[model samples]
Target chain A: QKEVEQDPGPLSVPEGAIVSLNCTYSNSAFQYFMWYRQYSRKGPELLMYTYSSGNKEDGRFTAQVDKSSKYISLFIRDSQPSDSATYLCAMGVDSNYQLIWGAGTKLIIKP
Target chain B: DAGVTQSPTHLIKTRGQQVTLRCSPKSGHDTVSWYQQALGQGPQFIFQYYEEEERQRGNFPDRFSGHQFPNYSSELNVNALLLGDSALYLCASSLVGADEQFFGPGTRLTVL
Candidate 1:
C-alpha cells in the first residue's frame, strides 16, 4: 500500500457549498500533516498545517488530523470558483522532514 | 521579497538528452529540495541539499542529481533522460530544520 492514500477526486460542487477532502496514511510516525492547494499549471501552495492530531481553522478553511485513524481532512466553507484546484495531503516524521504525499483530489466549485 | 523562483518554465528535450533546471530560494532560506510531479500524480521527493552538500535523497536513481550553491540556489540535473523523465519539476526552499516549505512555479519538462 502507498504510504499516503487519497482519492483522486474530480469532485464538483456549487458555489457556497461546503467541501470536504480526505486522505489516509499507513505510517503512524507521521507527525506533521499539511494541506496544499494547486491551481492548473501553478505550484502547490500551502493551505494549512497541523502537528499530530487536532483541528486548525483558517478563515474559510478548516484542517483536521486524526492520528488514531491515520486520516486527515481539509474542509472549505463558502467555496468559490477561485477555490477550484487540486488538494494534496502531505505528512512526515518531524525529524526527517521528508514528506510523503497523496495523489491529490481535484475539486471544482462551479458558479 | 521574492518567493522561490525556478527557471525555464517549459522545456522540450529528446530522449537520451540531458536537462538542467535552476532554482533560487527565498531570502534567508538555506536549504533546497527537488521533487518530480508526474501527470495526475503527487510530487515525489527527489533529494535535498543543505550547506552545499547533499543531505538526503529519495528513491530516484543516480541519473537524477542536484547541487546547492553557497548562495542557497540549487540546480537539478537529469542525465540521459528517458521518456519517463518527463514531468513537472518543482523546487522548494525552506530554512534548515523548518517544517514549512515554500515552492516555485516549477519547470515543466517534456521528454520527447
Candidate 2:
C-alpha cells in the first residue's frame, strides 16, 4: 500500500456547500500533517498545517487529524467557485525536512 | 518579500538530453527543496539543500541530482532524461526550523 492514500476526487459541489476531503496513511511515525491547494498549472500552495492529532481552523478552512485511525481531513465551509483546485495531504515524520504526500483530490466548487 | 523563484518557466527537451533548472529561495530563507509534480498528482519531494550540502532525498534515481550554493539558491540537474521525466518542477523554500514551505511558480518541463 502507498504510504499515504487519498481519493483522486473530481468531486463537484455547489457553491456554499460544505466540502470535506480526506486521506489515510500507513505510517504511525508521521507527526506533522499539512494540506496544500494547487490551481491548474501552478505549484501546490500551503493551506493548513498541524502537528499530531487535533483540529486547526483558518477562516473557512478547518483541518483535522485523527492519529488513531491514521486519517486526516480538510473541511471547507461554504465553499465557493474560487475554491476549485486540487487538495493534497502530506505528512512529515518529525520535521519538515521529509514529507510523504498523497495523490491530490481534485475539487470543483460550482457556481 | 519575493517568494521562491524558478527560472526557465517552461522547457521542452528531447529524450536523452540533459537539462538544468535553477531556483532562488524566498527572501530571508536559507534552505531550498525541489519537488516533481506529475500530471494529476501531488508534488513529490526529490531532495533538499541546506548550507550548500544535500540534506535529504526522496525515492528518485541518480539521474536526478541537485546543488545548493552559498547564497542559498539551488539547481536541479536531470541527466539521461526519459519521457517519464516530463513534469512540473517545483521549488520551495523555508527557513531553518520553519516547517511550512513556500513554493515558487514551477518550471514546466516537457521531455519530447
Candidate 3:
C-alpha cells in the first residue's frame, strides 16, 4: 500500500457549495500536514498548512489533521468556478525532511 | 522578491539521451530540492542540496543526479533516460531548517 492514499476524484460541485477533500496516511510519524492546489500543467501551490493533530483556518480554506486516525482533511467554503483544480495532501515527519504526497483529488466548481 | 525559477520551461528528448535542467532558488534561500510529477500523480521527491552538498535523497536511481553551486542555484541531470522519465520536473527552494518550501514553475520533459 502507498504511504499516503487519497481518492482521485473529479468531484463536481456547484458554485457556493461546500467541498470536503480528505486523505489517509499510514505513517504515524507525520507531524506536518499541508494542502496544495495545482492547476493543469502548473506546479502545486501551497494553500493550507497545519502541524500535528489540529485545525488551521485560512481565508476560505480549513485544514484539519487527526494523528490518532492518520487522516487529514481540507474543507473549502463558498467554492467558486475559479477554484477548480487538483487538491493534494502532503505530510512530513520533520520540518526539513522530504514530504509524502497523495495522488490528489480533482475538484470542479460549476457555475 | 522573485520566487524560485527554473530554466527551459519545456524539453523533449529521446530515450537514452541525457538532459540537464536548471533552477535558481529564491533570494536568501540556501537549499534546493528536486521533484518529479507524473501525470495523475503527486510530486515525488528526488533529492535535496544544501551548502553545495547533497543533504538527502529519495529512491531514484543513480541515473538521476544533481549538483549545487555556491550561489545556491542547482542542476538536475538525468543520464540514460528512459521513456518513463517523461514528466514534469519541479524545483523547490527553502531556507535551511525552514518549513515552507517555495516551488518554481517546473520544467516539463518529454522522453520519446
Per-residue lDDT tens digits for candidate 3, residues A1-111, read: 999999999999999999999999998988899899999988888898888688888999989888999999999999999999999999999867799999999999999
For model 1 the local lDDT of residue B80 reads 96
Worst 10 contiguous positions by lDDT, candidate 1 chain B? B94-103
Q: Least lDDT summed over 10 consecutive residues: which range in candidate 1 chain A?
A: A91-100
Report i-RMS for every model: 1.5, 1.1, 0.8
Sort by lDDT, best first. Answer: 3, 1, 2
| Residue range A1-111, candidate 1, lDDT tens digits | 999999998999999999999999998888999999999998999999989588999999999998999989999999999999999998888634578899999998999
Which ranges of candidate 3 are over 4 A from the true structure?
none
Model 2 agreement with the true structure over A7-86: per-residue lDDT tens digits: 99899999999999999999998999999999988888999999968899999999999999999999999999999999
lDDT of 1 at B73: 97
Error of 3 at B87 (Å): 0.3
Reference-based lDDT, each prediction: 0.93, 0.93, 0.94
Best by DockQ: 3
Stretches > 4 Å off in candidate 2: none
Q: Which ranges in model 1 have alpha carbons more than 4 Å from their true place?
A: none
Q: Is candidate 1 or candidate 3 better by DockQ?
A: 3
